[model samples]
Target: MNLSWQTRAQSIAQMKAETFDILIIGGGITGAGLALDAAARGLKTALIEKRDFAAGTSSRSTKLIHGGLRYLEHYDFALVREGLRERTELLTLAPHLDDPLEFVIPIYADKRRNYDHPLLVRAGLFLYDLLAGKYNIGRHRRISQAEALQLAPQLDPRGLKGALVYYDGRTNDSRLVIEIIKTANERGAAIANYVRLVSFRKDVNGKVCGAQVTDELTRESFNVNARAVINATGVWMNEVRSLSADLSDDDKQLRPSKGIHLTVSAERLNVTTAWLIPAIGEKRFYFVVPWEGRVNIGTTDTDYHGDKDAPGAVQSEVTNILQAVNAYFPSAHLEPSDVISAWAGLRPLISSGNTKQATTAVSRKEEIFTDRDGLISLAGGKLTTYRLMAERGIDLAVEQLRDHFGVQAKPVSTKQIILSGGGIKRVDLEAHAHKIARAENVSIETARHLLHNYGTNAEHILALTHEDEALKQPLLADLPNIAAEVIYAVRAESALTIADVLTRRTRIAMLGAAMNCVEKVADLMARELGWSEEKKAQQIAAFRAEYEREYLIAR
Candidate 1:
């Protein structure tokens, strides 16, 4: 089924009429993975999301698919190993979205990381590669200070010792989740965004059998009967669990830690590889990643007590990030003016210790809970390990189906759930881009951009350009995204609102051109999606407001 607005009506009918073998709540990467796993295993599956897929942490990730290399400092070898293994799995399953990259960590003789000598870094890197074992992308090596400067001219030269270079991976986190969702739908999973779970519908014996839900767009409430209901909501797990029964307030399973990131012009930050820079205080750290045409400097880990739905980086947080960037890259001279975009994401870390203390040390390990009432809830995990988390969550749900529902479903078979954009090897991608450029009459850069995000499906986008020659033009003068992408998002990617296109479907949001071309983007969307003039204005306003509220530095 094409995952478009047209298909949503049919999906809703299915959601209302069919009894599913497994119904999953939450459309983040974890939930999407679960739906794909269950459906691929020959179980009747359906998924519901209160908002858009990846509206929460799934879209707000640091945009990396690497193993948890930092976890090694605390001796969490198993966690690192599982993540490393998943990294290899993702690179194979979706080669285009998740590509391997070299990460440079420069050592300073007078910096706070005094313990990180060249030999010590080598030992850690060796252990990291050992954990990855056969799945390792590349081996780590030591680089002289001069060689390090050649890669990143921004690196501070004074008191700088040699650097350590290691291999990791990067990805468009939200795009990855959306592709997984589309694959699940193609495999017969009826998944709909903006359909929210209202409450639990229980049997006379008080075990979960179904749920009451409302479509947010239409506000029509209905019942969805399912043999097993799994709550995979990230930060909102507690809220969904509360709907089923009276759980204690003290039974909070998620401690949300807010991590914020900033994007600046790549020309200003200037780095060939991602940089791991240690923070000066709070025992913190951040990553300087090369993303799109910008540099992403991020991630302050502080316990977030604010509203989870509207997490934004405040001025002080922005100042701290720029300070870190400038301190590491003394010649970069970055300031608030240099920042193109800034946003915050709440990490749903599982609290295994004192909840009253800081959330910085909480584990990234995920846990699945089966309530005595038969409601299952999942919390805590990283984006890189989402597939593994789904496998484990669905395994337990399959057991529950046999025990209570009498539905004998097939075993998990998602190890082969080829993402919709799969099968494009790295070596083949360049030739594919050249072919697309020649056939579509677009720039090599634009063709490469489409292939990177849509992989083999780039042809589908190219087909749109033939119908409207104007669709080949760039969405913004400087951005690589073209107008055909907006139509593609509406027709193939199920993007509903302006936020869905600019924020998740395309790179406009964090790539820093959201405000500059909102009206142009909205006009194209209105023509394709059949929006009224008022709706177009509303969408433009909402997209601009979202950028101001979330992506802009609140100075």
Candidate 2:
């Protein structure tokens, strides 16, 4: 059930003739989750994305599957409970992707922070552990100043008393989203990337029925009819909503906030544990999490009133992160040059003006909107709670179906249904995978990497190598990626462009590489994808242009 160009063309052909039970507009985690839920519930489902899966904010997350310790500061008990519960569920579902990560928050007796900060933080951690009762990995503990310094000697010793060590989950957000799409495909949902929803379709009664979609790659237009059309475009919800005819000003929903993150080389700050610094200006604070062998420092929560598609990190936001981390780790002495990458994500929050004066004040809770014409839009939720959001969304759609078509849908069964790699539940999967690889006549290192990425489905990847030895060779000399992976992505994952193959299908963009290695990998992918010489040149130019825009350009 791998989604390919042929599958996409078939879906378009079917959409032109008949109506689907459910047509999901955004192919992100939420949209993909909704499609899986609907299809699992016996509904004919279809999902479309204008770009690659997770091309938007889902891929740009802080890459944490945590209970959000800072939410406790605002006394958000319910949000904390929901996030903690979802965090544990994700860890259980994807152990290979979501691993235990410890964070150390220094209890500094600074003039800025109240002297009773340690007690406050301890209370918060206690509540966090309690919320994650059965799912708790480890309890929070306080370490002495000497012990804390031993853990991270690079810290500034001025007024450093002790620190709190608590456990949470870290994950590769893009990989998780890709797995979700894979799981949806396994459940019989038709998915197409690089397809844009250009217009909306309505029935004779003027009720919302379907969408006129265009394949961005081929510039071919087709119409899809469905019992319900759901717009799950995160920050672009409003843009999609405008396509509906019967929507009014009152139904206009969504207030998006941009959060920026800066990536510094791990060598810049050689610490083992992640950090939660009480940064100035913000009501609570921000975090400096260590992820993927790099120091990921981020997240400035400010209103972004700019273009949603291409939001750039401002100079002030970068300065705020550098200044805060510098206050504690003065010895790291980080500067702009140490940054390998910088990214920004927009959080699509529902604005309830009476309750929330600012976007950050609004709950990250999911909201669903259905006009009189039945144009449904879902917005405002974190990646951790995507499944829960989907459950709610599908239930709402089913109710709409009963009213409109006099049909009743079956109950959702995704709660017990595991995802792609999550289907197998084993204790020592690492050792077991090695044995399987030996039987398949592949290298142990290659086997381990495949298992980490595809779980039991690693067999499929290796089988390709066994069939064609040339496919097993690494794509680039410096990278660990296999040449077969590029073909796999195009044939199975709907990677229409070189950027989709390099950036999302494989992590060539995120993985720090030498300048030549980056260009070489891009060129390799271009060749494998059968791009023309001019196209290959264009891709290299585009990759370099993006690099300069993100890293090299001076503020």
Candidate 3:
């Protein structure tokens, strides 16, 4: 399972021979976590996805690894505790990818807000710190109105009572997903992206034994068998449910809600700390987070009524975000022109009671349903608690496999294992980064960027530089990433399209605010990878279209 995207060819070959012990669907955080869990438990496992890894809602999150402080308002102690515990684990396991971030929530007067907002927020942060225990980054503190203004100059000064400051983890959400997939591959989980689950194959006993899959890029079809199949598809769970004809409407367990985000330059929000604004009439709070030199200000939770694959961030929703942020940060009055980019994602929420009652009232916890037909589906978990979701999903699948195959499997051991580049133990990460740069004859800045992004695996790209010095040159003249990385993503990460490389593998298109630089990379990639002229044209067109879709504009 050397979980690199390249392993799909081998997994597809192996699937043609016989059935695996467990087959997991979805390739986002939960699905990736499940694959790693199952493989580590000594269960012969494989995972498949319909799109690139984290291409869905997983990549378009607020990118916070907090204990859900707002959940404390709703008294969801269990969910908060579990999330707190997972946050500690993720920080310890992937330090290079996850780091501590300070946040401020200002108390505004005349807003008809709670008088004890500071104390309430303090209590939540205290509990969050307590749960993190030895792994906690820092404790919560209170700042005077003047101090708050000094920290965030753009914040509205009028009627400012005080602020509650706390620390939480921030991460590159998509990179974390990719690392999990790589770790699962290291543990023997065969995972592939751009592979769609077409239908289910049942055995003589009417149990789901495998799935019929179609390669979205090549349009080729194949069959793979498994003792137990798990559908971890986020918003697309109903499609998998429909594949099994015997499953009825009752089998559909998802009610997806749309979460939209606006990407703006980090300069717009000059504040260094992430800010949380109390919602005027909603249970939710808006977050202004920093990521990759940009401010990922989002998001608005609302009931979705549209296609999950091509969901658009309507102008009305964009207006809501801008209005809310402007209400707090008067100096940084943002408009549509300030938007570098925007995106919408469908959270595959489990439909239990009235999902429309209150957007904040909906559960953020996951639900596991093992049907009588032996198809296991896990849905409705937050990005913070994906590992727990995976552990439960794999635990259930193992029970089904042991009973069916008459063989025992090993216990899960992912809790203590370091993944991919995280396996490298470095006392001085900065010094190590410089060493790699000197060895590769690349600049220290370039080396530091790579080492931070990929940890020890940065050496792989450097190795390519030694073979071809030209590969060391940057893809775009101004970008830090080089051609070696683009080639590595295509050849090693199993990226099938130019958008996959620009959007996920390198994140150039999103950061640069257009595909102008990325299109040039795509053309260079086309020549190096031996892509047909028509193929290159098609990729360029697709890249432009996706840019328009995410930015909410028509070309």
Candidate 2 — which residues are off by over 4 angstroms?
111-116, 245-248, 251-253, 280-282, 354-356, 424-449, 468-479, 514-528, 546-554
| Ranking, TM-score, top scorer first | 1, 3, 2
Give one digit per residue, the lDDT tens place, for model 1 in 38-65. 9888899999999889998999889888
Per-residue lDDT of candidate 3, residues 486-545 (tens digit): 777766676777777787777776675446566667766786567888888888888888
Candidate closer to the true structure by lDDT (higher is better), 1 or 3: 1
What's model 1's lDDT at 128? 95
What C-alpha lDDT values do all the predictions have? 0.87, 0.76, 0.78
Candidate 2 per-residue lDDT, tens place, 29-124, comes to 889889888988888889989877998888878888877876776687787788778888877777667767888878877746422357777898
Of candidate 2, the 10-residue stretch with the lowest lDDT total is: 545-554
Comparison by lDDT, 2 against 3, better one: 3
- Top of the candidates by lDDT: 1
Model 2 earns a TM-score of 0.91
In candidate 1, how many clashes are counted? 0
Stretches of candidate 3 off by over 4 Å are: 1-6, 113-116, 245-252, 281-283, 424-427, 434-445, 477-479, 512-514, 553-555
Range of the 10 consecutive residues with the lowest summed lDDT in candidate 1: 111-120
